[model samples]
Target: MKVSVQGVRGSIPTSGSQTTQFGGNTSCVTLMEDGRMIILDGGSGLQKVTLPDPEVKRVDILLTHFHLDHIQGLGFFSPLFDPDKEIHIWGPSSITHNLHSRLNRFLSPPLFPVLMRDLPCEIVLHDVSNSSFEIGPFTITSQFVIHPGATVGFRIKGKSAVFAYVPDHEPALGPKGLIFDKKWISGFELMEEADLLLHDGQFTTEQYGKKIGWGHSSMEDAIQLAEYVGVKRLLLTHHDPAHSDTKLNEILDALKSKHTGQLDFDLAREGMEIELG
Candidate 1:
C-alpha cells in the first residue's frame, strides 16, 4: 500500500514562514492501491488531491467526524464537480441525522455557496460505526473512539500492509492515562500491530493539561499508545496550528533524545509518502 500525507495540521489551518515546513492544511490523507484511491478526512488539504488517472472514475472518502477542520475542504474538492466521477463518502451518524443531511448542513447556502445536491458527481453517503467493509483492494475497519462527537478511527488493510489513522483522538482522557487493557482502550483495535500508524499528537503535555477533553492527544500520549500497540512505525500528526516549525522541531528533537531506540517515530509532514508491506 502507498500512503500520502496531504495535510497534518489540527484544529485550524495556518500560514506564514513558520508553518511552511510542516504545512498548514487540516487533516487529510490518501491511500492508494490497485489503482483505487481511499481518502481519509476532507480537511483543507482535500483540495490538493488529484485523480492521477482520468479513467479511474470511482473514489471513496472516509470521514472520522464532522468537525470543521476535518470536512472544510469538501466543497473545494474537484471530484464533487466532476460528473463522470462516482464519489462514496463514509462517516459516523448521529441519532437525529444521517451522513448526507449532516454534510448538507455545511455544503448549503450560508456555509457554502454550492449545495451538496447541486454537485455534479454521483455521490453516495454511508453511515459507519463499528463496522468492517471492503473498498477495492482494501479491507477497512471503523470503530468509535474517544473524541468529541461521533468520531471514529480506521484500520485499513491492503494486500500486504496495514495502516491505522486516528488524527483526532484523546484516548488518555482519564486520570489513569491509557488503559492497559486492550479491550477497554479506545481506538486500540484500529492501531494494533499496524505497519504504520498516523495518530494525533497535537499538544504538549502541559498544553494537554489546559485543554483536557478538547479531543486531542499529547506527544507523550501518542508515543505511549504507539509503543503499547507495537506498531512498526509511528508518524505523529495533526499538528497544532499554533506550534511553529521551530517549536515542532524542538519537540521532536527532545522526544528522539528521550525515547531513542525504543520505537521508530517521526512527525507526519504534508507531501510525505510511505510505501508499506
Candidate 2:
C-alpha cells in the first residue's frame, strides 16, 4: 500500500515565512492499495490533487466529521459532481441527521452552486455504526474520538500492512474534580500496533491546557500514545495554525530525545509519501 500526505495543517491554512517548512494546507490524505484509491478527509489540501473525471473509476472517501477545516474541499472535489464515477462516502452520523444529509447540505445549491442530485457519478453514503467492516480487500475498523462533534478514528488493514488515522482528538483527560470519563482511552487502543499511526498533535502541553475541550491533543500525549500502542512509526499530524516550521522542528527534536531508540516517528509533511509492504 502507498500512503500520501496531501495536506497536514490543522485548524486552518497558513502562509508566510513561518509556515513554509511544515506547510499550510489543511488535512487531506490519499491511500492507494493495489489499484484502488481511498481518500481521507477533504480539507483545503484537496485543491492539490486533480480529480479524475466521472467517466473514470470511482473512489472511496471516509470522513471523520463535517468540521469546516475537515470538509472545506468537498465542493472542489470535482469528481463528486461527475456523472461517470461513483463516490462511496462513509462517516459517523451526526446527532440530528444521518451522514448522507449532512454531506448533502454541503453540496446543495446556494451554499454550493451545484446540487448533489445533478452530479453524474453515483454518490453512496453509509452511516458507520459498527466498529469494523470490510471494503474491497481491506479490513477497516473505527472508534469514536474525543471531539465536540461526532468524530472517528480509522484503522485500515490491507493485505500486509495496517494504517491508522486519528486526525482530530484530545488525549484522555484524567479525573479533575468532578469530570471523569475514560472513553478517550479506548480511542487510542483502536490504533494499537498499527504500522503507521497518524495522530493529532495540535498543541504543546501549555497550549493544550488552555484549549481543553477543543478536541486536540498535545505532542506529549501523542508520543505517549504511540509508545503505548507499539506503533512501528508515528506521524505527528494536525499541526496548530500558530506553530511555525522552526517551532515544529524543535518539538520534533524534543520528542526524539525522549524516545531515543524506542520508536520511529516523524511529523507529517504535505506531499510526504510512505510505502508499506
Off by over 4 Å in 2: 51-55, 176-184
Candidate 2 collision pairs: 54-84, 54-85, 82-121, 83-120, 83-121
How well is each residue in 1-277 modelled by candidate 1, as lDDT tens digits? 9999999999898878999999999999999998788999999999999987877788899999999999999999998999999999999978888888899999998999998998999999999999999998999999999999999999999999999999999999988888888987899889999999999999999999999999999998899999999999999999999999999999999988888557899999999999988
Best by lDDT: 1
Model 2, residue 194: distance off in Å is 0.4
lDDT (CA) for every model shown?
0.94, 0.81
TM-score of 2: 0.90
TM-score of each: 0.98, 0.90
Candidate 2 C-alpha lDDT tens digits along 145-231? 778888988999988999999999875554441122333364756687999999998988888888877888888778777877789
For model 1, state the Cα shift of residue 210 in Å: 0.7
